[model samples]
Target chain A: MNSRLKFLLLNLFLLCSLSAMAQEKINIGEKQAISSAILNEKREIWIHLPKTYNDSSISPAKYPVIYLLDGEINFEYYTGMSDFLARPPYADMPECIVVGIKNTERTRDLTPTKSQKKSPVNPNVILFGDSGESENFVRFIQEELKPFISKNYRTQDYSILVGHSFGGLFAVNVLLTHPEYFNAYVANDPSLWWDNKVLISKTKSYLEKNKTFPAHKFLYVSQANNEEQNKNWNSEMTQAIEEFKGIVEKNGSLNYKHHFFESEVHGTVSYPGNYDALKFIFKGFRTDIKKLSKNPQLLEEEYKRFSEKAGSNFTPSETYLNVVLKFMKSNDFKESEDYFINLKNSLYPKIK
Target chain B: MNSRLKFLLLNLFLLCSLSAMAQEKINIGEKQAISSAILNEKREIWIHLPKTYNDSSISPAKYPVIYLLDGEINFEYYTGMSDFLARPPYADMPECIVVGIKNTERTRDLTPTKSQKKSPVNPNVILFGDSGESENFVRFIQEELKPFISKNYRTQDYSILVGHSFGGLFAVNVLLTHPEYFNAYVANDPSLWWDNKVLISKTKSYLEKNKTFPAHKFLYVSQANNEEQNKNWNSEMTQAIEEFKGIVEKNGSLNYKHHFFESEVHGTVSYPGNYDALKFIFKGFRTDIKKLSKNPQLLEEEYKRFSEKAGSNFTPSETYLNVVLKFMKSNDFKESEDYFINLKNSLYPKIK
Candidate 1:
């Protein structure tokens, strides 16, 4: 072939290869049907796995699961976070399965109580009347979805329930009603004023009645200025929740943590909150420092072991070590310093 | 038709309508081509406009332009940052046109010189010997790209050139050779060790000869512990650059800033570095506490003006305002607190 023809053909091949590589589909979850009796509908669900899950040789190990609500909006964030966090150095957090529950009827599936409130745009079609589906939603998670996940994937008993807004309301509902359903709960600015603060009142009642419940972690967060207006729904609801949190700390059984982000709004707080929450929750679950430090070879051995077991060509990158060191420093987990130093040494011995 | 059939038809219609709405694309930018003799190639450029471009009512306003390299990796970050930084309390930075130059053969286009070393796998294929393309790259930016951008976009003469890695090398190259090309240069962890420290030696020689150059802002950043070999490269290059910076500072012609981030790695430093670089470059640009405090109405006027002119329907969301406040506090630019308060009052009158 002539030079011009060869160049054209080469360019076409390069373009095709690059496009194919760039357009590689992000692994979205498998489709599953979840039915809710309260909403009286079946919704599709998507569950994402960590990059290390394809190994068939390793024995099926149970993994922690995060149940995410508003899967459409937050699934990508969770996927990115989970993938990054599970990689070396940030491996303080274990690799877990992410179950993203897609919203079929958002208002109906997420709301905790029924209210006769028609949206302004479509007054004829009921917009905000359906509520109290959270109970059934939690049940669907505990009874239907959890069972399926346990049977299908290598899932541990430990699970985290995550939600925002109405989904946040559902997360709180699950925490109060079925504490045993999840090991941890992350509720980001939940709409607590729904049905005239019905959930808030129920929370007070639940805390009053139940004492010495199961050991678990609960994170409740709100925006900075969300508490300014007394009449405002978010304002009033957040105040009531804060008051309830105070009561729970003083005399209740559940272990609870609350963070108020002055900089973030309801919508934008999820990313930072989720990142902080995961770090906080898994602060204790890490490799022993002594084991890592005493024998520096242990760090390399562990990395190699996991790499071999997972069949991943994963060597800890410098980015990984930095993340691990930062996590260690931020958490005041000094015991892990030796492990981190050893990790750095092992990863970048040529630097010195 | 039966009730079931009618319901199904209605559902289908609604689904189609929702799909159409979701598929509606936001017109973000105009695609154009720029001719370059240095590279002997034509490069496709994506020029994004401020929302007011189509509106005839807006005046012939000139805006500062940010020339972003590795545009594909960071287009969304720039877009979001530009949109947020230009609004409300943090209006210190002017609304500018963003010119994203897409990559074509990144290694070839960005590298400074051509190397002759052969690869271990293939003797015919050279690995790191590519050098000397940097002059041509700068010429493309100086002669062709900048003029095209100025002619097309409503841009001010003041420009900021930004890049990472090899792109960063080109940015520094332009700043060194033709200091008049851009008002500010941001080199985020540039490959200063390219072609066995060719740029470093060139910079040293250039600084020794030229006592007084044009007044310009140069920001050089180095990531901590990015790679095993990069650690040495970053430190050695930084030391050499620091020596050069000391000379320039003594001469009092060039305003240079250097930041060493021991925490962040190469891949992740872009987010925080970009944030800091923008703040540093635009420090004391247009901020007046006395003026703002005296005329509270001015804040509202500015807010209204941007809101109307930008076509963004931006009314200073609580989240946006919070970001402004956070940025102001961090930067010690708290002069516009009253102005921000007034803007907040105008936006949400009922809250007060």
Candidate 2:
């Protein structure tokens, strides 16, 4: 090769290598697929394991799973939020595995009844044309998706279902149909106006028949500002949600909390609403670090109480115990340090 | 080869390929590096571009930048949060490019004064031994980092600075030292007790000399529940922050908001605090989409008012205008649709 050509090639190689080094990708999760017989198709799933899931220093741990609907839109932020909220020494909730289920036919899967409506904007046009096969969709999740997750990951018995809009309607429907599927449900700006408030009737009938929600079941519903929504369409959305709220509150047997975000519209409520829902569902999970320094046994006592209220056992993870031990050692709390060390050893035994 | 051996090899090949297909990574951002003369070292940066940054359908756009501190910890959630908030039709803020600067020497870069203190837990050991080089650090951001971002990305003139704890102290210090660097500043549970309230002194002196903050400058400070903090250490944190709040509020010239989170502690306050800070800083950004359908001119009017308050020029993006156009067309608002088509064409003209 000519000397000039060799010099140019070397320069090109250096530039390419530099650019490659600068473009390291930041990955939050990975995709997986399941051949679901019920759905008669290959369903794709996005899974985000907690940071400690692969740490070799700690014992392998089981995390509660959150099955989130509308996966493509919400997965990235939801996973990051869960990890942030579950940071140890001041964790608001236990570390969780986030499973984001993407939609193929969103309207068909999320709606509960075969009903259609004329467009709010143009009366001649129909909305939700291929609507209402939630029973089959729920079956796909409960039978196929749940089994796939459990068989693959170290998951706790506790699980939560999270959805927005029609997904929110699905979450409410699943709670009514299969309360045993998940311990908690979050509905963000749900389309309760569906089929002229069929879910409202279902909620009332369920309460009348059962007399109470299943023990330890939690439901968090967030309603967005309806003033702007009223300008767009009829006030049916607000009316339906209010009616459902009144029925639930009057029965007073369910662990329910409803928040009305005055500033948030339908599209934006899920971000803040999801944050608030985690805080509410796991209200007693955070134990004071200062108190833990003086009285280390309080850690186990607090966890026990939280577990009792949660209706599921939630032991402090090996990662959290390690943080507690480090805090104690650095602060010169000898007794507390010894207590946590013993606790860690007992919970996560080393293999001989 | 024997039939059994051939079959085994074929099975192994299928399994490997299946696993590869299933493990496709979900990426939110990418990493970049800058060999900085100001810091005298190569600094790593995490950059997240908004979804529409690379869309070919619309004209290339410029985005406001958010310089985030303690980048390694907060980068993931902060990026996702920014993208979610900037979604069209109900966007609370403009699309922003998040640049997360990972820490090399956290205490040295974030603290302002060369002062040491005894450990709150153990009086024998001192804390922050290698601290106090924030002036040089801010210089790195202004001279080195900002220039790098502006040269590489399609960045708008507007920018924001966000920090937490010691990072928060850095933000406050930079605000007092170089208010023109960022259009807005956020400090979440800032360690105002640093160096015996040195930043507090700087704030008072700055106000005394200047008599008023630069026009359109904004500052948001969030205070976590000090009740638990009091149990851990001295009440100096709450006292210093309250004193600074009083000073700023009394001056009453800067656009300022202080929130006291009753339920949040030091470790967890940044999550909610950051969300609130964004909402406060971009208070007038969200326009009623329904109203825009009736009065198309209101769109530009809203952006004009918001831009004035933000001290920067911010026109509606091509992508958002497209969303508005679609909303109008589907709603049969022919006049409004035509108006938005003209707006989009003018703002993002096509080259023949």
Candidate 3:
């Protein structure tokens, strides 16, 4: 065939080869509505686990949990982030179970106190309808939800509470009122403007009294650019946030972090904010294999430091050690060889 | 009750309230194996779609797709990022269908050419067993997978090819060999050092000929800090990447972007790399309601620019329109009233 004819024929073949069809559904996490005696309602929740969650051969261990409020809306995003961070390469976050609590009453459950100001959108209607149920909501999680999780899920003592907007307010409320419940709290763009900044003022007094915590706590607060949208209105909001930050900063017991994202609006802040929150909480999570391989002494120190922060003791799991070993063996590092030998001996002291 | 007794009683009540149960499984996306004629084998695939993918009620439209290489390992991470980016609050990314191509032969499929060097980790073992099959693999995707996906899924013309490490190398190869395949290509820490940087040298020649593309393609290249471990080894990788960047920079046909993640090593680059890639490709994705409300004209111009770039003559979809209208109605923007009417009129045309 001629070159032009050959080109035309190839194009015809390509077009004939490819055609379109119907699409299949991509399923995500499972949802369940567990009856909550405390809230006197059936609370819906979405649960997502790591691939190795049930693989006994891969990971035979308990994992930490991240309990996200507004499960129906926010569960996928948070759980997805956790699932991503937990895996190889990044390994910035450990594999864990995610429990997303779907809201029964958005205003009622998430809000700490009833608002005197009318709804921002509606003039006559209260901002929070049948509100200030957060105390009960926290109780439900503490008494009903948590116990159920412990029994059902492979949960460790370490727990994280993640919330946004009204949910963020609830998270902070839990942190102040019942700090013992979770090891870490992530509050993104919290509605501190609720009831004329009462929550912010309340935080200072709470901080004064609560100087000691049963366990160390990581509190991440992310501020959105609400000021740009509603400048005069958001003055109160900004003030409340600043005051809360000041109080938290002064409070030595709390491992507090505040990030102000001018570029990200109220809604958009959650993605990067939540990501940073997790990264902050799990600081030093990604093992420095190059550093460790160079100086074996650093591994123990690194692990020790991570244990103190991660809540879980820093002993490398068998699977984790194997991954490290593979990398080390690939390069042939002497210090790591000795380190792995010691680890193997300690784990299998019964042998030989 | 006495203060001490009251505290004790409260603690006891809290402790008694919560208890444990049997763990439930966390449901994620399903997996399947499709027979490929090109490879003469059934290739495993994992598919995850956006929430609105099936729910026509909320979003009566098709979505763009992300075709991920090394699907079994990287699917969760990529899908997770997309899921996070798609939803409210962080609606930074549009809803996307994720089609993860699970590897039957990682080295064989990913590498375009055979390596002279043996496996760095296992010297006796060849680096790539039955390698140099990327051309066949691409054909499998073009003739088999693409057609299968088109037949099965509600996919838009806007497709993204996401790959990491050796998979990343495959992505760029596809871009060079068949630029008609995808709208965007994300190559994260591409193993450009493959077969002594022959791929990098090949790119210049391909760029020299391919001055025009079927669709304006977005090509995002990310570099990991390989220098953190082996300076000399990383030097070659960096050189190949730099050469590719230099060539692409000179070539105007490719919408090029390069990001160097100093902190993230070879393995961890995929997380932030993929995230940034999506963000870069979908530049100005988040419709600035604040800007739109002020000057409704900007919305048209903004979307027009995007439409031109995205290969979709992107009229704001009905679902996107509704989201904007809801926010506008909530705030009661006067300028937005006309915009809403225009949108509603254009979409419904028959509404009373």
Sorted by TM-score, highest first, which candidate order results?
2, 3, 1
Q: Candidate 3 DockQ category?
A: incorrect
Off by over 4 Å in 2: A1-23, A229-234, B1-23, B232-234
For candidate 1, the lDDT comes to: 0.62
Reference contacts preserved by each model: 0.00, 0.68, 0.34
Winner on TM-score between 1 and 3 is 3
lDDT per residue as tens, model 3, A141-220? 88988888889888778899999888888898888888888989999988887877777777767755666544568899
lDDT of 2 by residue, B1-352 (tens): 5565455556555655654553498878888889989889999999999999999988999999999998889998998898898888788999999999999999999999998998877889998899999999999999999999999999999999999999889999999999999999999989999998999999989988999989999999999986655644438888888999999999999999999999888888899899999999999998877888878999999899999899899999988888898889888899999999999888888999
DockQ-sorted candidate list, best first: 2, 3, 1
| Global lDDT scores for all candidate models | 0.62, 0.90, 0.75
**Residue A68, candidate 2: alpha-carbon lDDT:** 95
lDDT of 2: 0.90
Q: What is the interface RMSD of each candidate, in Å?
A: 15.3, 8.5, 22.2
- Model 1 segments more than 4 A misplaced: A1-39, A52-64, A89-97, A115-127, A148-158, A193-213, A216-231, A244-257, A284-352, B1-352
Best by TM-score: 2
